[model samples]
Target: MRVRRLKWAEEFLGSAEVVVQSPQDIKGNWNTYMNRECIHLEIGSGKGDYWIKMSDMYPDIGWIGMERNESVAAYAVKKSEEAKENRKFIQNEAMHLLDYFDKEIDAIHLNFSDPWPKKRTTKRRLSHGNFTSIYKQILKDDGELHMKTDNSALFEYSVVNILKEGFSIEELCVDFRRETHDEDAISEYEQKFMNKGNPIYRAVFKKVKEEN
Candidate 1:
């Protein structure tokens, strides 16, 4: 999906308070910037609605939105600034997450990530074994990962990959609204899917210690 480039997006993102020019500067010191203990990361944060809302909902926790597209990321950064939330937007791809962050995240939110359904592109999925390995490195030993999607195939694939990577599934819901409505955070894409009567699948996986 090619995002339409906004004329002032570059300028806006550069000056946006929530936009991080170089995440490497913060590295493992993210808590210092937010002055908070719990930090959560949202991968493929499209327009930042979910994380921005989450920041408002959970003031005690710091939020980080990661996106590769500058145009959409600009909107997220601007929104975070306007909300005065403890949230930051990083304009970078999820694959290089380790390059910017160390073992600093308490939880990860994967909301409406790309399915990458093709067999050849399976490795590109956010929940793939390769990406899960990277996530483990940057996440705490007991860190949790929450994923929501409308694609059942992608959800199933993610379940298999997540378990294969040694994470235990704590919660699984084929219809998130029915199973976990109270805890659900509706994102832009999630709202669209819900309006169309699509059932959302959600899962929470926690990292468990491996026995020697």
Candidate 2:
């Protein structure tokens, strides 16, 4: 379903200090804004639930939430403001991630990303080989890529593509809610699906440093 564009989204987002209208402006200086050394980024961060909560849960690590839709990005920004957190929000597409971030990111999170179920659109999936290559470029040598989704097909596809990209699967869970750890904070969509008795799949892929 298409999100209804909020008439005041642009104006509201413009006034939000947490929102970065042009991510490229910050580029490699993301940590400078949050005043932290380690930074973690979340792609397709819907309504900022996970990132915001995680930011509070881990005060030492910086957080950045990237979302393309202005309407939804606005809500994420609002949540950040309400929490009095300095977490950053990028109002841009994930495809152009390199333009906004450098190789300083310590980790990347993909929470409930679009499955892109069509065969022809498989390459558009966030965990596709092409996208994984892009992620490898920005992520540090030991950086981790964590992903969660309720769509079984996407989870399986992600595991295949991640392995093909030379990433080692550190952890895997076909049913996240039942197997989640104490530190894991549930996102809004995740909680909603879990309430409906749907199983959530999760994986942690780490880039394997090539032996010189």
Candidate 3:
């Protein structure tokens, strides 16, 4: 599908590197436009609107969003320029997150990722162990992964999968909107789901230290 070009997306083009190669393009050294510490990553950041808002809200933390779709990534990169102090968008696949980020991220966010509901397509689900293993590689010790979903089956599967991957759940909410959730950021998909009367599930899991 051809993505509609947003007027704001044109400004940041070519100013940043378009990371086609996985982890190879992610530089550990801080640049004048990038942040060196307290970095956070978001996978499947469709248009990056939510993360852009987050970057504005939190000035001290660096934010990066991974979106394979060029058009969507463009939108994110454009908006990031508004709060260019510490935010970036990578045009890469979710499966290659570890390739682009080292073990430096403080947190990772997954918002309404592909459910891959079919029995035969389970491996494609973002919450599967394979993806979590990749997340573990790029996450710092004690790093947190925040996930939200509207699919009940996928949410249940994620709880089991994350546990199998040695992560401990710190928080889980089946009804986030009604629960005592802080006035947190909401993704575009999240708002759409809420309009349809669907409930959202939220969870935070910490990476367990690997014992030799």
Point to the candidate with the largest TM-score. Answer: 1
**lDDT of model number 1:** 0.86
Selected candidate, larger TM-score, 2 vs 3: 2
- TM-score, predicted candidate 3 vs. hidden true structure: 0.85
lDDT of 3 at 56: 71
Instruction: Give one digit per residue, the lDDT tens place, for model 2 in 91-136.
Output: 8878898898888788999999988999999987889887888888
Steric overlap count per candidate: 0, 0, 2
lDDT of model 2, residue 91: 83
Determine which window of 10 residues in candidate 2 has minimal summed lDDT. Answer: 79-88
lDDT of 1 by residue, 125-167 (tens): 8898888998888888799999999999999999998999989
> Scored by Cα lDDT, where does model 2 land?
0.85
Q: Candidate 1 at residue 32, lDDT?
A: 88
Models 1 onward score TM values of 0.93, 0.92, 0.85
So what's the TM-score on candidate 2? 0.92
